[model samples]
Target: MSPATALRRNSDLGAALAEARAAYAAARPRSAAQHERAREVLPGGNTRSVLIYGPFPTAMTRGQDCRLWDLDGHAYLDLCGEYTAGLFGHSEPRIHRVLHATLEEGINLAAVGQGEERLARLLCGRFPSLAQVRFTNSGTEANLMALAAARAFTGRGTTMVMRGGYHGGVLTFPASGTNAATLPLPFVHAAYNDSDEAARLARAHAGDLAAVVVEPMLGSGGCIPAQPGFLAALRALADETGAVLIFDEVMTSRMSGGGMQARLGITPDMTTLGKYVGGGMSFGAFGGRADIMAQFDTTLPHAGTFNNNVLTMAAGGVAMGEIFTPEAAEALFQRGEALRARLNEIGRQAGVPLGFTGLGSMMTAHFRQPLPDRPYAASPAEEALRELFFFDMLAAGIYLARRGMVALSLPVGEPEMDRFVAAVGEFAESRAALLRAGGIAG
Candidate 1:
């Protein structure tokens, strides 16, 4: 398979580590005590496992510019970038002002407001594919609506979930559902871009698959962008099989002006968006064809109490207006290229397999050889190296996703990128010295 094809694939990252010692050491005494106290009330001392990293997670105080300061007062250049949602960075002055103004107008009245309609209009205008939109409070809710619409429109229960594809942590697209289910459910587990395989799976459940939901770019599963033919093939298959093609752009929307689907020139029947939509406020949305989206009006169960909360709409509107510029998106892509180039050059000098590649604004560094487009199902050693590199990166002051994806925001520019590149250089140098003492893997 081509590198792009393999990049559409997913690898097994192995385990959730507990950097208890490191996490403990990193926390201030009061913060550490708070963590200990919370364990009694909050399970695992937190609500979400995704938020808690190995050892324990840091207690964040606040963010400004492109940096985060923990409760212990240790400041780290924010590279996680709020999982790629804080496109304009934390507490941006202009966005804050807009939101503050919205608050003065009253929060909500249990009915649609001009703010909601205006935000939706801007979203639809910027994304040509989103002709009509419904605002939801979370990406999962947006995806749920998309899936329900597909099922309602197509009258099929089964949805084709790409193997290892994550869609808002939904069971309809669960990690194990693709291969293990037995009935009219998420019955297909076709690997990305394998037209023949997906073709076979669709035929096996002939006429039963309502939709084929895919992430144009995998966010949680190692930041792997789909190969070119992959999404095109899915689009074709959905048409042939009469299945709804839904692109879950929740996490991948930051990739371009219209998101990864636009970057790749692939359009689906329905597209769900979130993350950046909130613009650092809580928000989510899904939009598509006028006919298909008519399902939203079908009086089905798609309502949420805080669906289009006024605050999210106000801030997201301002954020969308500012961020949808050609200059801003282009500048972000350029920064991605510069960061990757510098990192790879240092990788060469340091003798590590460290390299970065991505489409539009998304990018990630790998500790192994230049990866193929498919999930190599990385061997045990390769997986170990990935984990070791994560901890090493932490030791070097760059906190990246344990999975290795290094998403960037508009605020992250030359200085931030340079600091990040330098960290990679130091990692590479130390890693190479270690390898020289032993040996290096391709």
Candidate 2:
């Protein structure tokens, strides 16, 4: 395309996005009012930064099965699935029953309950690495404790992390630099999915390295799965260097009943877990080699006010043991795999610069320039296209993260899957001209 043509196409794209943003704002009057009211109390009318977007976000009023209804009366298919925490769907009956019973029985009991032990035993039996476990309030806490354990166990201060890895809120390293809110720690950032880079970092910092923390699949960071053999290399490196390997399965645990470690056959020294493990409740857990986890021995000073809360214990046990059985987990994984394959196929056929990256039950769509010989990196144009796609999906009655992330819940059956794919097809067709001009080359 000529420079003049490119400039005109860019202008058209900007205008189209502006019009879409207006349509989004106009569709949710009630949500706009709610946001205004909330801003008085909550900063930016949001507690979670990921949920926020320009022109305000639609306030969801209720959810059931696989759907959500915003305050403005717009219904959404809820492909976001509360970022995988709502794996059981909004109104899972088993969870309801357990929660009700636990609530009636009272919470924060002064005594240890059998339910807690039962849940721990169930987790230990399922995940090979988790010989012993400890509970926390959220995935962030789980990761925090896991790292603390690694440092204490290895008697080292430095930790190696991927550039795009997100362990917890304060433990995030989305890029080369740690965010201001990141916990103070000696961290060495390494390129994700690059076994060579990871190995080099591990060996270079061998003496100071306490742990190598990573997500089996980068959930928040564009849903990129670890390259084949990358994880095994990390396992071998950790073994060679005496560094603790911590798999932050806070998102990828849903990939299998035994978590990703079981699927990959590469067990880490420690693992952090959260999300639907708590049965759609507030929960986090970290556990691994019994000796390393033993640092939390009752004789030592370690505590969480609600670590053994009765409701979470009871509900989590049912979630893992009864509700999300091994068979159910495998089924969900298959469904996600099929859906993702179809989506990618459609994007390729359309010759749109759009694609999805992820493993079972989790994925993120990106509008990029083209496949690079190296690891994927989003360009500025791709970033704008992603934001535009978010609005397009929202208009089509699908709810997903602004970053185009999607997670399949058990309730997302064939009908919902078909609709989601159809929506993406429509979006690509509607924006074909702009996409092709931007190097999509359809």
Candidate 3:
């Protein structure tokens, strides 16, 4: 396209985005006021970085059965699924019963509780790699403990992590550089899904490498599933280099009963889990081969006030043993697979430059064609176009992450899925020219 034509197209895209932002702001007066009040203490009126977006975010009041109501009283079909922690949805009857029963029994018993062992056994039985397990308050804490254990066990300080992989808050490694909040570990970065580079790095740091941590599917980095052979290559490299291979399945654990490792038949030395496992409560777990986890039993120290809290343990037991059984997990996986296929088909039929990438029950929409295999492989998403899409989806009564992430909850049935699919089709058709002109098709 000529410079003048390109400029005009770009100008049009900007105008559309501005109009959407204005509409979003106008529609959420109460949420905006709430944010202003929060700003009195919270930075940018936000405690979580991901929750922040331009024109402010809609402050949600409550959710139930895959539906969320913002402070402004707009109800939405919740596709965000609390970033995958709402697997059982906002209200699962069984989970609620368990939580209530546990609360009645007591909380923070200050001693090893009865509920912990049962939940631990269930986890160890499900995941092939987890011979033993320990709990934490969040996935971030679980990863910290896993890395600490690996470093202590291997007697090495250097850790290898994939670029664009987010294990937790402090363990994030973006494409360009480490996030400001990242832990000061001796982290060496490697590209996601690049087994050869991973191999080279492992060999290079073989002597000092304690662990090579990765997400089987990049979660916060765009839900890009690791290519076949990539994870297997890491396994081989870790064995060769004497480095502990830790799979951060915090979000991807919902993929199956045993997670991606079991599905792919490639197990890691350690696995970190959180999200949905606690039946919607704050939770995380780390476990692996008995020998590695044994250190925690004696030499290494693992302590947390709420590690064995009755509420999480009891609720988690019900979540794993009753609600999200292996059969249920398989069914959800199939449902997610079908949903992703349908969404991609819609985009293709509309001739729009939109795509979705992910594994079971979790996906991210991309406004680019020829979807990326890794985060850095493609240019950054067109923010204007992405924001426009977000606003449009919200207007259509579908709630998803600003970054286009969608994590399906158990309560999200055919009706919710149909509405979401219809909304996407509408967006694709209405904004085809703008989407095409945003240089996403290339």
Q: Considering every candidate listed, which one attains the maximal lDDT?
A: 3
Candidate 3: stretches off by over 4 Å: 1-11, 377-381
TM-score of each: 0.87, 0.95, 0.96
- Candidate 3 Cα RMSD (Å): 3.1
Global lDDT scores for all candidate models: 0.71, 0.87, 0.90
- The residue-by-residue lDDT of candidate 3 on 1-442, one tens digit each, is 5776545544588777777788899999999999899999999898899998877889999988899999999999999999999998888999999888878877777999678899999999999999999999999999999999999999999999989999988989987755899988899999998888998889999999999999999998999999869999999999999999999999988888999998999999999999899888999999999999999879999989988888899999999999999899989999999999999998899887898999988999888888889996344347777778899999999999998899999988888888999999988877778888774775
- Residues 82-188, candidate 1, lDDT per residue (tens digit)? 67777787868888898788778887668877778888888787665788999888787787788888888888888887766766644433333342322344556
- Candidate 2 at residue 275, lDDT? 91
Candidate 3 lDDT score relative to the true structure: 0.90
Best by TM-score: 3
Clash tally for model 1: 9
Clashing pairs in 3: none
- The clash count of every prediction, one per candidate, is 9, 0, 0
Q: Which ten residues in a row have the lowest lDDT in candidate 2?
A: 368-377
